[model samples]
Target chain A: MSGDPILSVDRLMMRFGGIVAVNELSFSAERRKITALIGPNGAGKTTVFNCITGFYRPSGGAIRLSHDDGRSIQLERLNDFRISKQAKVARTFQNIRLFPGMTALENLMVAQHNALMRASGLTVLGLLGLPSWREAEKRAIDLARAWLDRVGLLDRADDAAGNLPYGDQRRLEIARAMCTEPALLCLDEPAAGLNARESGGLNELLLSIRNEQGTSILLIEHDMSVVMEISDHVVVMDYGVKIAEGTPQAVRDDPKVIAAYLGADEEEAIAVMESGT
Target chain B: MSATSARPSHAAQPSGSAFIVKKALISALVALVLFSLMIGVRTEAGPQGGLIYWTRFGDLAALVGTVFGGSIIVELLRQWWGPVDKDSIVPKPVQSAISFAGRWLAPALLVFAVLVPVIFYDQRYILDLSILVLTYVMLGWGLNVVVGLAGLLDLGYVAFYAVGAYSYALLATNFGLSFWVCLPLAGILAAFWGVLLGFPVLRLRGDYLAIVTLAFGEIIRLVIINWQSLTGGPNGVSGIPRPTMFGIPLDNSDNGLAARLGIEFSPTHRLVFLFYLILAMALLTNWVTIRLRRLPIGRAWEALREDEVACRALGINTTTTKLTAFATGAMFGGFAGAFFATRQGFISPESFTFQESALVLAIVVLGGMGSQLGVALSALAMIGGFELFRGFDQYRMLVFGIAMVLLMIWRPRGLIGHRAPTVYLERNQSISSDLVKEGHG
Candidate 1:
């Protein structure tokens, strides 16, 4: 898990007619680490994630997920369900895609729908109003309750998910993904609406998940505190190019990383870094 | 992580006292229905005993329960749960719709149902019209699955109806099959046809699906018309058997039913029996459908109807779901068709036309796309009303057009349109708490 890459994406490209949203991006995110992809607006950060998650079929790239047989297969060729269920990649949305019409508990349970499919088995079990379906339904509810508790939302479990406060909705989105028990969790803008306290709690939640469940995290966050405090390794990009990658401290000082963040040319970037406010 | 700090407030939430009262009202209404139905049956049928007594009471209870229960639960939802759900299983667009339509449709439906019958007293014509309404109710329920639940508009649904009627006609004529046995066979054959129709339109959507299905119906009709050997062709098949009592025909011949039973008989008895038979079939249709609605697959169907993309993302196999709807719905349509063949004892290719599909679709939509009771009411109004209007001669279609326009303007979603129960409870869960219009809003 330390040196071996779990997800290796190479030379990924997504072209819409003439414009390239993601241009030849390449990176490897290893197991059980908080890897941050930081870039300015329109830097193709989210597009790259979409390609890996199989929401978009990349035009030219190899996204290989390491398997138990010590081989890798291209992820881009897989369907969305295959990426989610087979590749074990769970994701949240930029706009908080909780099923608004369902209760919070149901939203969480739907995330674990594939698990319930086993209870509805081949024998006369599911057809006869069998105890197995009942048991499975109960188990699903219990698991949802546990997740709600983890997210500090147990009291609001029965509430319609749309009614939740903005902060709780964010937390529930994360809890819903964890219900899938995926190998790689992709969070798109988790820290978008959070204040200092909520952001801190999010940081703590990610750190605990990484430590306890051995789950690798790939997060897109604009919050500097969240990105810098929790991220073990940061990949900085600008104008669809990977400018620098290393430990946070080293990348923070790099001329290219500084230029990218400041939206400046390299020469102007060095002048600002040299003046050193 | 959200900016909504401070402990979440429950200040705006309503209490549950009203829930109890609503339940009480429902129970009382059910009791009244039992009492009224029994009195009505005793006064009308001139005798009372067996399941009719129970049925009279049971129907009374069900009618009372559904209405009282529907009203109480809704009021409680508003008072206790908030008119616009902070979070509800209904989509936002659908919720806004239910709210907008509910404001006027309720009173208009009641007024029309009561006033129409009172103003028209032609009993002979009314009975004929009532049967028509019942037929459409059956058809609407069948089409609801394909169009409303599965979101598949089928312009060839009448093909399955034709199959049922033709199968019953052919089998009973050639081999002398009983109505009961032929009934199941008709359903099975129709389901087969449904699946066959389903395969061709798997990739089609909207108008494309509609056109292909229309072509399928036309193909079936042409085959019936052109098949010179098996089918009688355009002249159609006649002298088909009417429903009988143990090989005894209802005619007043030497060995007919009256002579065998040694009792004077009227043709109306058989008509009544046929009525009961179709009534039972319609009830069975309703029961099975209601049960299916409670299943996970049923919920998934509704979810799919709402959003196909989200349904797929949930890992539901859309293909299987669509096929099941087609098969199940087609089976019911066949059952109705078989009954039609047995009753009329003749069928023609002319019966399975594009207009038949339009009538059924109208029944489904006018009753509110997914409402069972609504469908039944719409059937009664459209078909029964149309039949009753026979005395008007040439004015029937005009009345229908006027009524339809008025109905649309009054309740655009159709009568008793698609409304799912707002509250779900365990078997032992009492309705005592649902008495008022206020609770955890």
Candidate 2:
């Protein structure tokens, strides 16, 4: 909370044709903190994630990332890969997008593609079987193994990513994102389909990611347990407008947040309905 | 077929004896009628005047009987064996055997390829055919990089082939360069073209990408045909120099391999030398591709193939991955093309046609994409099979069609569908093709 915000969004706007998916929303995610962006379906939470990750160009606003290397990057100006590679921001899709044909270990290795490509001299040295390439490859495999161990998928390292169980695939996706060594990890929905046990594991994983790895996290999730449990800051949106933003307890008790979640206060709603009749 | 299989006939009971008999009878009846109409009756003008109907009853009966008898035997065997349950996992012993073969098969094939000309030193035709098959094998491996690993459906791979051939033809003929010098140059020129072609088609995916590439191939061929001054039009460039060993050719002259080695020169020596040259090039292509697959860029190519969006999200540049795949694949195609020009001592647009692209693609698909040994084996089967049909030219296409169909029905994943993981922590297991995407272009 004390560190300058890792991500600062100001007046973000996303328009598709005549409709505004996200409008005039502003928020900040602190360094090494878990920030949750939650709302009902189609509330543009995912849109904000996409815009911040450079998948979609924002209609208006600046997405500024304060990098660990003391460089502040405007992600809106970069392409999707440059955002990840340069700004050091990584993301995962809501629907699991693991490479179906590649084994679990390979998915992680591929995240370190830029580093390894440089080491291999862009295939020239690698093709010659040089020792430099071998060292780079060894380091890549070691990092992949470390992340695999962190996600508790080291035993299934050889199995195809697509073949892993649903929860395991989710964990693998996180492991893959982590392997990129991102300064900020954005997960669309990490616990969307997980059961209680899996979500518990994910909570523990996210906590360690913030505490041990010290990577800032921004997640779009509908799973309340995950949001309430690990999130240091909570930002709620309704119809692309920020309704409340604070600590989890403060946001939980906010009247506007309650109305957004439960759909209008009972007394006000009843009075309006009576007046209409 | 599914409708027929789904039908609940009493004949389809587990015993299936009656089912076999019914299938045989139906097949025989269909064959008998078709053959009778096609071959039984004929009309000829009589020598005296009028036309007379002539019935070749003995020939008709023999043809009908053969069809009936063959179909019945086939049906009986099919019933006895039962329909193959391809969905079931491969048997443990069979799987292990296949893995063993997968490991040793390439080296064995390499050794066999090296020794073939020596064993059949007198038979020039066999050596020629071996070289042809190896050429296709090389071309197939090239296409495998684009279509298999990168999952870019390049239907115009032949354009690079033509580029390579013409590069060598132009360089060797105009600049008086050696085969070895033009060889790498040809590859570079083709890869340059590949990237040029790749740039415009970057945004396209799936069938659209395929169509654009197909158009690109046709364009290259058309350019070669129309640019008469450079390419000699359809007449082709001739007397393209054959590759030499070091600085010497493979003839009986003072500078030839035979003269240098103090041996009597026969035509076999030249043939044998060419075979070894192609063998070395093919092995080099294989070695480079295999080595690249272990590199990060190689993995990125595969990752792009799997899911481009996810690959981009993971920080791997999709454009570069795709371009590298195209350029690498095209470079190999160029090498093969240069070899083709040297081998034939000719260059023509007819040599680089859509059919060449299709044939190379068939080799990759039939071998299973992303599988190196698969491409080699498929090249052998396809090229060797076509050569075997030299006497029965009319039926070659039909046989190829049937073979392709049967192979698809038997193994939809193509032969050797198992993909060995590039980087594995402990067990290096083969991934089943069932889990692979039917890749977008």
Candidate 3:
């Protein structure tokens, strides 16, 4: 991996009234690597994710994404929609925010909206069913089908996204994010409600995405097994502050991380860390 | 064990006979008081030149007796049918047959619409009434793009209708343009207004958006009224040219359509022609909407409707999605407006009022949001039913309100509750509206 960081979040602070949800947080996710932000409940991991994804403007900070093409974007300056469209930053919600009424194929098609819209000549040519627009639609459906196949949901492409089983929906969400062709993918609690097997499936999906597409991923995960197995770098937070940042193994062994997040003293924390996690 | 009371009782559950009878009696008494005032007394000018009331005890007695009888029958039916409704099931084959008809109903209605004016060519009243119904059908379809597809509650849709009407009116009268030339021009002008109105309210949503649109509609109407030098105001612009076949008008001139076609010079020819024109326009609206629904922008519109947040996350620019929906819908409204101008040969601000907006919205809601066939069906039912009940005068609105309430209670999702998913893989499936969530985007 290149030493240059793809995303650099500097002194990020988010406040809701008097309460600081994210306080002067700083972290850098390297190019084409899986980065995990882990913390206890209300440790501001999601708040940080929201800030990065442009769902919420940080009270103070700079979130910069430096492209391989040598162009850099200040994500905080862009609107929520432009963050995804222009910045090439795609994200999934903690609670699975798929378009519930649309079919699974349509959910993926919707992800490719900008590409299809441009091909449609901003809808005029599409209305006339022009050849170029038809070709774009065919290509979009092909891309959607390929993603569906990868996610093992090709058979259920006609089913509504809401009708998909939980595990499949999780996979579909990743596939949807992939359809956007983002340079950086952010996932919030992807394995939050998954069973052991589903969590394993998610780990494989995230790994394959990184291996095949080489897209950098920034994720907030509660499931340590998935995080430990997939994450190249781990950042641990407590009370809106990053307490530990290192490789997964090093961060897992961090005393402050265990004391604050795992609720263990130094001695017991060492024993828990040594349990081959 | 007492926690059962925490959960409210099921209102649909069977009640005690004594309780039911008591409830029915109360309803009967309430009906008695209401009908008493309506039917009990007749007011007339007295010999001394003052109003006097004459009591009609027989009429009051008959009304009270009817109420009691009606209430008892209703109570009995409710008791008997309540459980049956919960338990009833249709035979498999019959259910399939109904589903088959439901699937084909939209095309069937289109066929029926094309055939109606022809079948009633001899009856000018029926043709005229059908024309009116088709006009509302077009308006409802246009509004469906904004309200049904985009989930934008536009209470001032009549503003676009006014813009369309006035565009055709002013153009035809002032510039002496043909109706055909002005039709698309009116649509374009209305779409421009739609964008103009859309820009200021890009950030607003739901009820606030509705209120703003309502204000814009009133502003347009007030402008048309006050700017009499341009629009002719309350007196309206008259002698507007009617849309003709090529250059031949639907008139008794030697070069007119009746003369060219060697048909009788009856006014019914014009009514029939107008009916077909409006029908064709409504179908075009339906076609374009259906085609748009499958396109990228159209899917964006629906995605925005379902979840605006998710739409933004998906990288769909919601501002453009919303504005395009407004412009497209307004264009259709303009087309319908131009047709209206041609059909009436006159235009007035009174024609484009809040009441007109309400009527079109009622058609869309009563039909089923986003369902083309449902809008057409509802327009026919609402507009034709109104014509049927013309003799009732003051009671017409009251009866219409009750019908609407009953319709809502019967089918909350609307006449056609199933939503056809825009894209499908294996087979096209109609989604139950209960499964479709709106305004979450």
**How well is each residue in B1-441 modelled by candidate 1, as lDDT tens digits?**
343233234334444667557565866666575668554344323255434332355666566666666666756666665334232234557556655655556456546434433444334454445445556677789888777666677888888888888888888888888777788999999999999888767567777888888888788889988995777888677767887765677777778878788887666545555655676677778766765554455545554554454444445556666777888889999999988887777888888788998899888878876677778778877786776788989988998898999898766767754345321321111111111111000
Q: Candidate 3: which pairs clash?
A: B306-B441, B307-B441, B308-B441, B309-B441
Q: Which candidate leads the pack in DockQ?
A: 2
B179, model 1: CA deviation in Å?
A: 4.2
Correct interface contacts retained, every candidate:
0.07, 0.86, 0.71
- Full ranking by lDDT: 2, 3, 1
lDDT (Cα, tens digit) per residue for candidate 1, span A113-144? 66765665521254456888778867777887
Error of 2 at B411 (Å): 1.0
User: Per-residue CA lDDT of candidate 2, range A10-95, in tens?
Assistant: 89999999999999999999999999999888999999999998899999999999987789989889977998899889999999
Q: Which candidate number would show the highest lDDT if scored against the true structure?
A: 2
**Mind giving the per-residue lDDT tens digits that candidate 2 earns over B66-152?**
876777687777667765554333457877888899879878987888889879888878889999999998999899999989999
| TM-scores of chain A, one for each prediction | 0.92, 0.95, 0.94
TM-score of each: 0.70, 0.90, 0.90
lDDT of 3 at A256: 73
Q: In TM-score terms, which candidate is top?
A: 3
- Candidate 2: lDDT of A249? 94
TM-score computed on alpha carbons, candidate 3: 0.90
